[model samples]
Target chain A: MSEPIPLLMTLAYVAVALWLGVRARGSHRMDSLEQWGVAGRSMGPVVMYLLMGAGSISAYTFMGAPGWAWSKGVPVFYVVIYLSYLALIAWYCGPRVWAFGARLGHVTQAQAVADRFESPLLGALTSLVMSIGAMAYAVLQTIGAAYILEVMSGGLLPFTLNIWLVLGTIAIYLFISGQRAIGVTNAFQGGLMLIVAWTIGLWAAHRLTGDWWFGGVFERLRDTHIDFLTLPGGLGDMSFAFWTSSIIVSMFSFQQPVWLQWMSADSAQSIRRSASWLPTYYFVILPMVVVGFIGIFSLPDLERADTVALQLAFQQMPPILVGLLGAGTLAAAMSSSEPYIHGTALTWTRDVIRPLFKLSERRTGQLARYLIFPIMLLIVGPVAMLNPGNLIMILLVGLGFAAQMLPAFIGLFVWPRATRTGVLCGLSAGFIVTALFTVVWPNPLGVHAGAWGLIVNLPLFVAVSRVTRPASDATLARFMAIVAPRRPTSRSAGEREPTSSTIT
Target chain B: MNHRLIRPATRRGKALLALFLLVILAGLWPAVLLANHAVLILGLPALAAWSCLIILASTGVMLLANRLLPLPTSITQADPTKAASGPGERVDE
Candidate 1:
């Protein structure tokens, strides 16, 4: 009887999520690509804040962070560090991206980059790279969702069925409502995840150590496993170089494809406001980390460290709490997964297929909506079924690829001298180096493979830009005016104003 | 709440930028190594406490930056089709 309760609660959560997704299509016509792709850029600060926050904190934080804490110890703090900086990155970059999207009718990150350099091929390349990254992320989250249900239900739900149930719910709602469904559902899931994280974290600590304050847990660990509380961690693998490099690579990789869409889905002020408050949401990780530390003494030498939190839930928590944990973990997985699935389809259609086929706006939007089904069922579904690699490692590998786009972003936002040829060459070089290091050697010399990519990418970009012709001066002026508009001086006031275009 | 954009050239903008860099540095490498100990601070590990503090500091810095450097009117108020077009005709989408 108790076995059925956890599965029922998880199913109930799924039912409510599906209802919310179906109901999210309220009032909007959902006729245009802009309306469907970005919720017509109408999300307010509260919803956008939750959407961005939930989207960033995925199954990685729910399961992976605790797993690392349990296995490696203080090294897992890199998650906290990188996430804090991500909000800062968003605060500074979100307004500019939103302004570009709103004023120039840009819908995707690749579109903005391609426009900056006047290169359709460049945009296609970017779209492909970003699609791969998004697919990897989606696969990770699907595996996470399936794992949560399987663990929570005592294997009754099974991994294979859970994947279908999880992805099917997301694909249906996404097909029906697009970005609006993501925003509404993420807001609800984000709140649920925070509550569940703190509840389970504190409960585990109190039940194990008889102290709700977490001091007792630390004191015991210090007495028994002192290395767990220090650098190099329990496994002795998280060296200074590894920790620092991981943080840097993760921080730079925060400009994710889906996040760019999220930034574009609101007013500049609303985006900035949401970014300013988003870091506080990262406090959700604190208790989850504590839960990992609690696992050290209670269930040592586990075969799979990622399941530490769930294992504790099953051992110490009552059936109802276990069900809530399942729901929250599922929420984390689904909320993050939806955006990537939607983003992959949107970018693939708009940047790749549309340009290749010269499709009309109406036709392109229709194609993007239709592409969601195959992406989930055919691509993401099969990869997730394999349950490929460790959760954190998969995240890092995808981020490594995403980080290569840094040079393109520099051309868009900061440096006016960045040429199309230079960006393309630099991005290509970065990708090769990253792929080689990530797969061939895997973090040589204690630094992250992604950082190794950037080390080579940036200088090559500068050298190539110096040799190659820059964007036409007129193009530079138009682009700069929007991103870095000059002050209205009496002399400059006579200059031509920035150009704009209608959303196609 | 202020609608005016504060260019990154300003003193406040420079200060905020510096603060951002400092906060990031505080959480990595040589700076983090200082707090990498088994000692407890307010019940949490010293390293954990330091990392958490850095995150809090980052939040404070971003909030300060937001107040000091609001977005420009061109960004905040311009219509997509009618806003200033700089020097060139619009590039084809």
Candidate 2:
């Protein structure tokens, strides 16, 4: 691949992203905090779709997903099960959440939970945990981006520049544009990556190795402990039961941020519209798996599974195509990292700093943007220093933690009987349990610690909610008013129900 | 025979479509792994030609189905009739 062309392609992607960011700048004139955080509570379906998709189809879609598929085979597609679960949850839970945000003026997930459950402490704690997880996740993305750049450079760029460049550019954009820029850039990145993703998949499949049975590759894998197709490869791999539950739990945990994105939609109907199409964005994963399978066949002796895409693209494909693939990979990384960074910062400002310090809306927003600098440092700095061998494992670990939030969040929404004290107990129990299991063992009885945590957490949630006093009816009614789709005004008056398609 | 030839549009229909796609991809894997033959569509060795056609056609059907389905109302109703000027009115507002 021509060095100049790939560099130029990278520049082109940045330029298009910047142009979209600039175009979106005029939309940031909200006086309220909610407006600032949630895009003035007016992101329509199209923007919502784009923003949500961008938030999701991040570096994982490009590199991590395929990288896993390349290494593990079909299990990677298990990630899509999360999307199916999310869509179902959104269909049922989304309208209420969006309504709650709109009516009560919820700008952040912390606020959404806090107001619903009427607990400031829960909000703060939730925000803190999200921030920690997101920061770790974001830094991994930075590391991945840096790896892609380093790979593109064939080692001349020192790999670290990718993290710096991505962080620097995003910092500038995030500072200038806020969530608006993030939303716009996300939309652009989502679309660009989707196109380039299919292109790379098709090109790689047809061009390299030309559909020959990978006998040599099979022989290589067969020689190893893994069957290369089945799990429990020799004897020590995770059981099918454990794998399914882990996927289910991990995917379910990712629902919150994805759901939070739905709240930004201009209309609820937009969420639905996006849902109908957004799963297609997920179609990128299958192609990634194909890419991974190809990598396994092509580079049988590769030491690092994640680097397969970069290695294949550079060595085999044309320079121009390598550059495009490079951008797609970057898109994947940024899509995941930028949202995590921005969301972490936003959560900290809203759920932690503002309530603690009683800062004004503008000040809080400003603080949120400034918070990104340190977060970018934390996220990128550690990985660069540590150089973790398996970025995918780190990502899955984060997913396990992220999944623990589910029990707490579901309690806030459905179990009106759920109390602040009980929730705190459940969360504490879940967190401790997950941490303990993850730290101590490979996974007790072949199940992920996250599965164990949920197993412990849900029963606790039920017991606690049952034994405790319900949140006040006033609070429940207010929450229900915002979240429930049909207001009496809309229902009895025979009005056209508000469209739920809003997505960003 | 009609039931066999024509797929049901029940929840089963959507699942079937998804399953069909998965089968096609899965079937192609062996060729991908072993045959060393380029994937052909109308005797053309372009995977994109096959995949793109799938994307375009499927996306169209998805859009059409979604439009026809009875969906819940949006969270916000922007009725020009109400003429209520809110801060959210401007895309740049």
Candidate 3:
């Protein structure tokens, strides 16, 4: 890897992000919780599009996805399959959350959940679970940025220095500008990820095989090593059940950023309109997966799966483009990490420490910044440094744990019978089972632990709720505004009928 | 129609629900077995071709489903004329 060009390019990229971070600061003083965490509800459709898209197609998409394609073969497309419908889920869930945010002044997912369920305990529980999930996710993104630094530098910058530089940049912007910086950077990064994925994928495919070109990379796989073309994949490490459940599980994890972005936008229609273009944005990842497929034959027994995309870029692509690619990959990592770091910070200060000590919102926002660093650096970053298997492993661990949020979220607006006690019990039980499966001992049968946890989680939530009395009709009706169409408006009384969404 | 079809909106939902389960089945399991064949489509292994097509089709289905969805009153509640014009106009609070 020609270190200097990539290093300079990446430095320039970081500088631009820093400038944007500074520029993102509003004219109004950053005193309140909304200004800092949500960027004052000023983001438009374009910003929302990039924010939501980059929230997903992160280091995981740029690096982990292609790596999975190299290692896992066709099952790697599970990433594509699962994500195709992601925006729809957001479209359905987000508007209601936005309405609640608008009417009730909710900012975080935990706050919304707590408010809807009428239980601070549930909010606290959500905060704890999501905080762990978000911080752990940030660590992986940190590691991703560090790995890119080392790769681009050809190991001139050691892992320790690389991580600090990467995390330090993120931490600074997150500290000063908060969500505005993240939104602006995400728009930039989202565009870069698409461009780089295509450039490298096409170049690698052409340079490596030259047989069928970029279009036929998989065909070449079929001709030579046929296993990579099919599902249940090369080694049969996953079954259909596993792939199905895994896709479903990922659809639900740590969606707080998407929710927050939805609420932050000017209107719910903006959220949906922004989301409509996401599928096209996500299609950029396919080329990167093709890059990895190009690698399987080209690199020929590469030492590590994750390095395939970078390794190809270094070997074949022009020096300046390679440098820009490094920047783009880092963009992919840092764009998502900013939100997770801020989210973890908010949850820790708002849900955990505040409830215990009863701190005010303005004070909690200040303290949260101080709190984000240690939580990220110490607890989460250490686990990532342990090199917990691979990039996808770390991402899944966070996502699987976070996917536990799904049942409670769906129950919030959709299930009138759902109770606070039941949701709390379900989340706790599911999380424990998921942890055991993910960390200690996976089930012998080969289904994903998150899936197994859902098996326990859904039934238990239903059973517990059935036994427990429902929340007040007031709570049920308020939350039900999402899935059910809007209540019919009374022209005279100025009240909405329970059944219809139309204004009369 | 059964209780599942209490409304035309719910009917579309049922159709989408069926499609959802089908997509899941198609995403995994017996659907992917087509890759075992030697055929090729557009330079992909037949199974690869099948899977890629499935992904594209799924996206189409989702977009179509979204189009078919009952427009929430919230969109109009934000601004009546703006909802019809589609997303560019600035609405006053």
DockQ of 3: 0.16
Instruction: Report how far residue A233 has shifted in candidate 2, in Å.
Output: 6.1
- Alpha-carbon DockQ of candidate 1: 0.33
In the range A1-504, model 2's lDDT, one tens digit per residue, is: 336777677657766776776666685663334544556546666776667666766677767666776666545544554554354445445555665565555657777667666777777887877665676677777777777777766666676666677788887776666667777788878777778877887777666545433333333444452444444322225356665576557555743356457666666676666655664566666556667767876777888777777778877888888888888878777777777777777888877888778877578877877787887676556565477776545555556667777755665454445667677777678777777777667478878888887888777877787777766666665543333333322222323333212111
Model 3 CA deviation exceeding 4 Å by range = A1-3, A209-213, A380-397, A482-504, B1-25, B30-38, B46-55, B62-67, B75-93
lDDT digits (tens) for residues A454-496 of candidate 3 = 8888888888988997666655554544445443223332222
What is the lDDT ranking, best to worst? Answer: 1, 3, 2
Model number with the top TM-score: 1
Task: Report, in order, each candidate's fnat.
Answer: 0.41, 0.06, 0.15
Model 3 lDDT, residue A269, Cα: 66
Q: Which predicted model would earn the best DockQ?
A: 1
Backbone clashes, each candidate: 7, 43, 1
Model 2 residue runs over 4 Å out of place are A30-32, A208-238, A254-259, A378-397, A483-504, B1-93
For each candidate, give the TM-score of chain B.
0.72, 0.34, 0.60
Worst 10 residues of 1 chain A by lDDT: A495-504
Error of 2 at A214 (Å): 13
Model 3 chain A poorest 10 in a row by lDDT:
A495-504
- What tens digits encode model 1's per-residue C-alpha lDDT throughout A327-412? 98899999988898888888888888888778877788888888999998898898888877664465565678788888887777
lDDT of 3 by residue, B1-93 (tens): 000101223456667666755765675666656454656677655655565665566656656666776456743254211222111100100
